[model samples]
Target: MEPGATLLNSTLQQTDASVSLLWTLTLVPLSGETPRKGPATMPLFGKSHKNPADIVRTLKENMAILVKQDKKTDKASEEVSKCLVAMKEILYGTGDKEPHTETVAQLAQELYNSGLLISLVENLQVIDFEGKKDVCQIFNNILRRQIGTRSPTVEYFSSHQEVLFVLQKGYETPGSALNCGIMLRECIRHEPLAKVVLHSEHFQDFFNYVEMETFDIASDAFATFKDLLTRHKVLVAEYLEQNYDAIFDQYEKLLHSENYVTKRQSLKLLGELLLDRHNFTVMTRYISKPENLKLMMNLLRDKSPNIQFEAFHVFKVFVANPNKTQPIIDILLKNQTKLIDFLSNFQKDRSDDEQFNDEKTYLVKQIRDLKKPAS
Candidate 1:
């Protein structure tokens, strides 16, 4: 049987036996085209039918059951999607003009809190960046309305640290990150609890995990992180000042680590950290050392294209500064022949059609033209 029908049947079984009988009798004629009598006057000996409290309780009970069953089934996601579509229709005042009023808002919260909606988002495997964006839009719409006397949606978001982590870890979808960030941003904007959570060790761990695992940080992850940093730039600046040596030590360890992929990710993050104006002086001092320059130069021939690309960009940045430019230039001049060969091979193997290829070719040409005569 279909899930909705099964749920309705279960609800009927749990309802008052007399109410069930009345519903059945009323619907019997519709099945067989035979006339049947509806419920007549009820006995006054039992509970009264006009109790508003009982009616509201029954509706809430049925809605809870529907929600629970919806969560247990894999089809729960499909139903939630359907509900979202229905909610959107209601929002636009286009479909089923039945006034859900506050009921729809309650239903949306119930679904979100029950983990059904999050599961749907997590299980999405297709690369529909735009669709995930639309889902975020719907979530934002539902979140905007005051559902009752409770605090706004941002309050719920601020308190639900675990939920945020699940969304970040499970979705791993780039498009969803912006919404997740926006949700976090609102928490910081409106709720004081957000400050504590954002600075928590757990939150930092989550950020590190996302940075390590996510492939295209430039799209969603980068934007979100940038927003976060921009919002809390002063705090970040202070943190870096206090932890500069430790962070550099960690980076040095990562550079010598066995896990090439993780090492590359660490290097990429380091490059980003270096790009920060607050960290510029410290990063330049570290990179200007001959030992560090040679180490980075060695990475120019690293096996991974990502690592090599990042190293190249970092080198370019380092060379942009007058203090560090001479050392970088001297290193490049020393390895001109090897660098030329590597660039030529890199150009020929560039099958990914990334826009960076032309930029890299241009840089290689500039390097060749700048090569000095042999001593």
Candidate 2:
């Protein structure tokens, strides 16, 4: 046997063994309530992974190969997608605490330093949605992993603001919108990134994006919008306070949107933001406005039961406010009969919701017992 032939045979065997291992690991069977940890569960390297850096190098190389081959779709990039998923599993571990190893922590830092994350963000535009989701799942794992007190990926991206700017640009494409939205929401856990996004002009585009003709992308953008406002209550309150006129100007448009889903979901998120204890000032300012009340009132007449139900919750806040402004009082007073009639028959579908029933009863009384003022 020639020396070159022996070397080639040995290399082929190693490649075959690795492929076999990947197949076995990916096909592990589920047997119980708890998740099963298949072989090669370590970050980067498999179970026998000796060096974490090698695993990072292999993932980066595979990612580069996939990037070069597929500029149009990810369906044909199954092998590359599988490799990414396997890396995620290894880094995240089977259970919550199991993968928080020292090596895994370093793996997070190394991936950041290697610039692979930027490549993943850029690939969102070119890859198919499933491939994009695989990339997002990896990001979710990174954001969820903590080195000491915070996520390494979050820490890295906090300073690398340009990556986030590109990620936000994903909203421009339907194929990438949902994946980028998910990754952006994960990044919001780090306050610096959150503040940058909230303060930037990207904040204004949210309303338009949420109204996109593409339902999936629109809904995903809406979720990201809601996450930004609700995830960090204190920060959101400050933003709303500083930019209330502009933010709610757009938000009210969302409430008046012809899209039933947008109207309903925005109403629901509005209720959440107001009812949250941290948003007292925001809630006070919001319910004080009569136009907002009128918008909620019109929403009550929406044909969709879901929209009507959500609208009822928000409308109750305006009536329930003790310090209602004259403008607010005037709207409620003029519509007192209609409001009473509406609440009388409102939310019968929620007859079993005791709390809702009590609230409805209270709101009706509040409207019924109203005064016509000194005039």
Candidate 3:
């Protein structure tokens, strides 16, 4: 054989073997699970793995391949996605085959110890679109793993909260944003993870993300930000109270941002946080601020009816404060007649929202009856 022919044959053999290994590893059945269909599972160099730990090890190896390859070929990513799907199938059964609880539990522990989740998220930018989705599914499934009343994945992340924050950094990467945001929301659903993120110094970064130039990234981030703030009400209330001035300082900027979406979402979130009974102290403090009241009043006049409507939900809190501060009362009295006229006409098209109209009338009556602190 010619030297070039031998070289080409060697290359083809190597490629074929790599595919065989990936395929073998990809379809490798967990302990006691049924053998997968299609190509039969084979030995690696010679050793075959049937333990559930082998599944986790295989995942970590492919995940490493994704991380190490700065310039990933389509074939490489396809193999990784296949591995991810296999892992997902193990966690959630395919068709009539229910997943083996013991196998899943073993896989969950192996995944946590292997540090695969962190590696996957940190290298998510290198992954292709479809593979990113696969990673999201795999990560979310692992995140849902539980033992009795306790969630092991959530516990793992509570100490390794940086993984969630790493996911947040992806918000800046165009390919990574929505995928990262999805995993992020999943983690923060657990109170411990939410508490860590809520208290992270970078927690304020969400403010910047929600106002970015890209609509999809910004909107997805806003959704995650909303979830973190609203998912665990008690944790969120503590976060808001402990970090009130700083939290709302960033929040207040969003209420007036040139990005209309930012302004609308922040206003809506403000109404939600301020009105929740759990956040009574925080809401009381928020409504007492003359500056906050003024911001809400200005938002009331925004050209977008949606903004005006969201603003009303927040603005009414200021009006409804039974123990309104002198400054709050002064602002309401100053804008009393103007507010009545504005609320009277504001979002009038929502005639079906009897509650809104009633609230509007109530706000009108509240301001109208204000005695200006008996001064």
Candidate 4:
């Protein structure tokens, strides 16, 4: 053979050998065949596999080559999509004569661990609601184990990019919404995910889920849910302006709940929603009521520091406003002891952080001013 032709043949043989190895490793378990542990046996087309570790190492190396080569080819991403589709079908579709649950589960875990599943989910955009719903079902089943069984899955899915997909796609169906609620509830138990999810566009979808009946299953869904509520001040302000009556009705009902945590969360959400210029007129009606002030005064003594802080902050804001200042003054005269105690505790426990110290100083100044001699 000519030297050039000989070189081309050798290259083709190596390519074929690598491709064969990938196919064998990826499909052998599904085929119920114990993996073979040596070279291809064909001359000039063999790839030695020294051991199980060697097989894995060779498989990873070949996968990288395949990905690189695919990247160079026209429509390589399309080909990859097709491969993913075929893999999904084999794992999720029922058309196969007999599905290998163990192999499929292993592949799902491997994909999740490598972050390929998350990447695939990010790339996914289905215009068809039904198709989106089906994908969500599969994703939910795969992630359910992670959400319920493993602790890390909560953090993993709470990633901004990952939860963004859930927010964008999970609202397609009621079932998907429930799945997202479950995931978010687990995520909020940890601070990192909670912080990310609270500020994300996903938060709107989260509120939507809470508005629906599915919220009953995850009561702690809003345990510290109030903290996130304060972050979206503008959005909450807008929502309250348009939905004040509905919100007030729900707030009233929530206050009667046996779960003090939920009640405090509702109050905090209400406070955030009402802490805007637009809602000021309507909020005055609630804040000025003697009974409402008493309720807030009671809340100031709640065991949860968050509830105490939020109640005092809301009271301060309401009293600072020109329209509600007199009613607030009246309440303060009636509950001077409680107000003094709260201010003293707040100042004593205040952190040295400049911002917190500034707030503490401002509160003390406000309290001093409130006790000024009458003209």
Candidate 5:
């Protein structure tokens, strides 16, 4: 064979071998091993051999799918459900083992970084019954997380405050209300998050939420609303002062609410606030109005003993305020006889309360001293 022919044949044969190797590489898996996804990957069997981050990551992806569709697929739902259960166990732990603190810290940080909390709450309707509970547990557990004195999770919430309002929106959805309430209640325990909720325009919605037709939801909403107004007294005082007109306007509506519970609770809360030293300014402002005095006076005669009792507690404040507005003084003087007569017989069953007996005596004298209209 000639040198040129032999060289060409050798080149062709080498090219054919290279082509065969390339085909084999593309067509076959080496040793049949699939690429490892991560520890705690789904079909999660039991506990994962990998990191909890895998659970957070998989759960986040599944949640994205769940959030986009109103009707979630069972497979995705179950997968997310499984991850939620595992997440709960990871954060709160099982009976047999405590959750590793470091692991939880890592997971909490990752969850925030991924914005999973925002997604979970905004799409809470997609999670199933038990899964919704797991979501709540997961959130509260993470919310309790703090590094040193600095609460990283609280900071995350402060930055992503929309999550807090989404929880508020949950009140309208019966399925998610209590769960959202639980989460929101926890969030507000941290001052930053509470301030965010108190200052937001959404705060107005809480008035309506507390009045919703659903008994449990309205009750839950009232609990949250009360906390917002009373939890951080200093913060609340400032908010009330800045927004007094708006706040008390809604409050007055509650005092006149057709719902018995609403009227009673509002009256009780009014007394509590007006009596609180932190709310001195608000109380003074509230009692300055003759219209407010008239409302409390009317409530003092409400049919329900409980309502009347609560109203009397508020009514005493008006008669007791030394700096009574001129309108307020006129109303007190006009009702002086009726006020003394009513207090003498008011809540007779409360005779056991020494403090109440004394206050009733004090109010009677204050009204009698109102320079009786020369009758």
Candidate 6:
């Protein structure tokens, strides 16, 4: 045999010995000895071959076993979590040398082929928060590899769209909400899956999620909610054009919500959506509505400066429109004095914001320049 083959054989044997020692450590608690205080680090590659292919195969087999466990028990769930953590280490390995990309792609394909992706979504409803986060990280890694590949990802998800809905429904459970919202956002990076989510009747449920009493869960859900609305520009624009009235009605209610955070964040995201060039049609239609302007006008007087600031961005869009619709112009004409008074004092703390100051001056001048309607 060649000298290189001999060295590889020696390395494999040593790796096998390390894995054997690790396995012995695992069985020690079962043998009634005191358990280790913390988890022992497990190398990603092991067995007689000790190579990337071996690591991928081992991770797949171990994950298959883990997914079959009754995830309700703490012991079982913890073990499953450990298994996922190890798989994550293999796929997202750390060292001076980056983990082999081809090896990780193979492992990702193995997870999908082994049907563990489906199992992860199913088990998410029962797993602990850390476990759920690990599961989401795995999906994030897998999709990052598969982003532009002309592969079966879309087909796989399209066939199992319920998995997407399951992640969405996860928001209903506070324990799972944050992680599952994270997973949902990662999944939404695919336009096909995003479309499914956007058109689903339950899409309305996010309004409730952003307003939930649990602060962390509500904030996390809002993060996903923003991704859903903003990630796919064309899809969002089309959805807005089709569902404008119903959807904006819910958003209008959000703008008026008593919760300050809810109102503030909704205004911020609204500005982002309207400012995106792809939503030009949506922005124009939204600004032309006098009621929409009225809602923003109330936001301008909000007690919170942050709300007033965000509302100003959206408010400027209406003011900057050269061809204002009759109803929109009518409202502006009626509220000219109130808007002038408010803009004069708005975001005063942002005096250093030259552009904001400039915009404020422009809005004041524009509102002042509006001609009074003929009697």
Best by TM-score: 5
Count of steric clashes across candidates, in order: 0, 1, 0, 0, 1, 0
Instruction: Give the Cα lDDT of each candidate.
Output: 0.54, 0.77, 0.81, 0.52, 0.84, 0.78
lDDT of 5 by residue, 44-158 (tens): 2323324778888888878877777745567689889878876786788655458889888888877888888888998899899989988998999889987889888899888
List TM-score per model, in order. Answer: 0.45, 0.75, 0.82, 0.41, 0.84, 0.77
Candidate 5 or 1, higher TM-score? 5
Best prediction by lDDT? 5
For each of the candidates, the C-alpha root-mean-square deviation to the true structure, in angstroms, is 10.9, 10.9, 9.7, 16.6, 14.2, 9.7
Q: Mind giving the per-residue lDDT tens digits that candidate 1 earns over 1-375?
A: 356754554454345566746755655456658787765543321332213233233333433444466544444334334444444544443322453566555555565556444443444333144435545665555556564655555566566556556555533445455556555444444334444544555444443543445554323444444444445645666555665666566457666545566567557766776777876666666777666677776777788777887777666554445454566678778877887787667635665766657656765776676656468
Q: Name the regions of candidate 6 deviating beyond 4 angstroms.
A: 1-75, 94-110, 128-130
Q: Residue 331: error of model 1 in Å?
A: 9.1
**Where is model 1 more than 4 Å wrong at Cα?**
1-138, 142-198, 211-235, 245-272, 281-294, 304-306, 317-375
Cα lDDT tens digits, model 3, 117-234, are 7888998887777778888988998888777898888888888878988998889999788999999999888888888888889888998999999999999999999998899988
Ranking 4 against 5 by TM-score, winner:
5
For residues 271-311, write the lDDT of model 6, one tens digit per residue.
99999999998899999888888888877777887888999
What is the TM-score (0 to 1) of candidate 1?
0.45
Residue 231 C-alpha lDDT in model 3: 91
TM-score of 4: 0.41
Cα displacement (angstroms), candidate 3, residue 116, comes to: 1.6
Q: Which stretches of candidate 4 lie over 4 Å from their true place?
A: 1-134, 137-216, 219-239, 276-286, 353-357, 371-375
Q: What is the lDDT of residue 188 in candidate 6?
A: 88
Which segments of model 2 are wrong by more than 4 Å? 1-86, 89-102, 127-133, 347-350
| Candidate 5, pairs of clashing residues | 39-50
lDDT of 2 by residue, 124-200 (tens): 66555566777888788777776568566676777777777787788887767777888888887777789989998
The best-first sequence of candidates by lDDT reads: 5, 3, 6, 2, 1, 4
